[model samples]
Target: MVLNLGLLLRIPVAIGFLFFTIKASGQQRYFAEKPSISFFSDGLVEDITAANQKVTSIFDALNGEIAFLMNVKDFQFANKLMQTHFNEKYMESETYPKSSFQGKVTGFNANSSGTQQVKAVGKLTIHGVTREIDVPGTIEVNGGKLKLKAKFLVKLEDYKIVVPQVVWDKIAQQVEVTLDFAYRPL
Candidate 1:
């Protein structure tokens, strides 16, 4: 008996399928059901701080793909008036209900232990505007979990978040944004 050309072709195809399956099955995924996003605006009148807990995000340990979803109205402030102004006046939450970020972590390796520095470069959508940015962040992997943290400054004008002249000085020209997420295996 001799091997046929058809059989040789099928052999390579089967091997390729097997390789992909094994590779995908061996790699793990991580996710954050409830991430935390905070923004602080230090103003001349008073300091304003707001936080949102209903942020959802996902991370692929093997591919380093990262995504985040945040509801604009979910942000809570100590002062209800401030919250109202933020949603209605600044963010227009009703018009733009959601904010998102889609980016990748370069050279991300979850198997490595300790802390690692990575830059998330992608589009960040806020206040009905999208801009490409590179955010520096750190990821700490211990045991079976990974904790990601990042902080950066965002200019309100960059996203077309206009601040009225009346309260211009009351609010900071730039806003400080912070992200904290704890991811578990998926």
Candidate 2:
């Protein structure tokens, strides 16, 4: 049996094409390292604040795609009783254990090596309710690393988070959420 020269010549070209295709389709991915998320509520009776450091995020610099995930129960409050109540009574964390956001980053320049103001336009899911939102944030790029910071207000009623009459004076109708994420290349 003899091998055809034409067929053998086409093998290298086919392999090269396959490699290029794979490389082109593989977008750059960045994973957050120790992301921080927090929220604060100022009410007539008292102020409440909580934070969650165990958050996960993935960012695609090339296409401006980003996503975030965190367990609802991970938020920690200064008052343990408040934390418990937040999870059970307010958030219903047992039924909706996680919160997430998925969307694209607008007004971002991937090639720029400085801080750029951007907006994440996407769906935010919390307490089993999803709503489309546009969140303004800043992305700082230095030495090939990325850090994202943003603060936005979330209306409890939008997500069906009910504040009982007994606690109306203690809980605010809206809460300010802040997040900071440092991402490393994946």
TM-score of each: 0.84, 0.85
Quality of model 1 by C-alpha lDDT: 0.80
For model 1, give the 10-residue run with minimal summed lDDT: 1-10
Off by over 4 Å in 1: 1-26
Question: How many residue pairs in model 1 have overlapping backbones?
Answer: 0
Write the residue-wise lDDT of candidate 2 on 46-142 in tens digits: 7999999988676777777777778999999999999999999999999988888878898888789899999999889999999999999999998
TM-score: model 1 vs. ground truth: 0.84
What residue runs in model 2 are displaced by over 4 Å at the alpha carbon? 1-26
Summed backbone clashes in each candidate are 0, 0
lDDT of each: 0.80, 0.82
Q: Tens-digit lDDT track for model 1 on 113-177? A: 99899889887999989999899999988888888999999999999999999998788989999
RMSD (CA, angstroms), candidate 2: 11.2
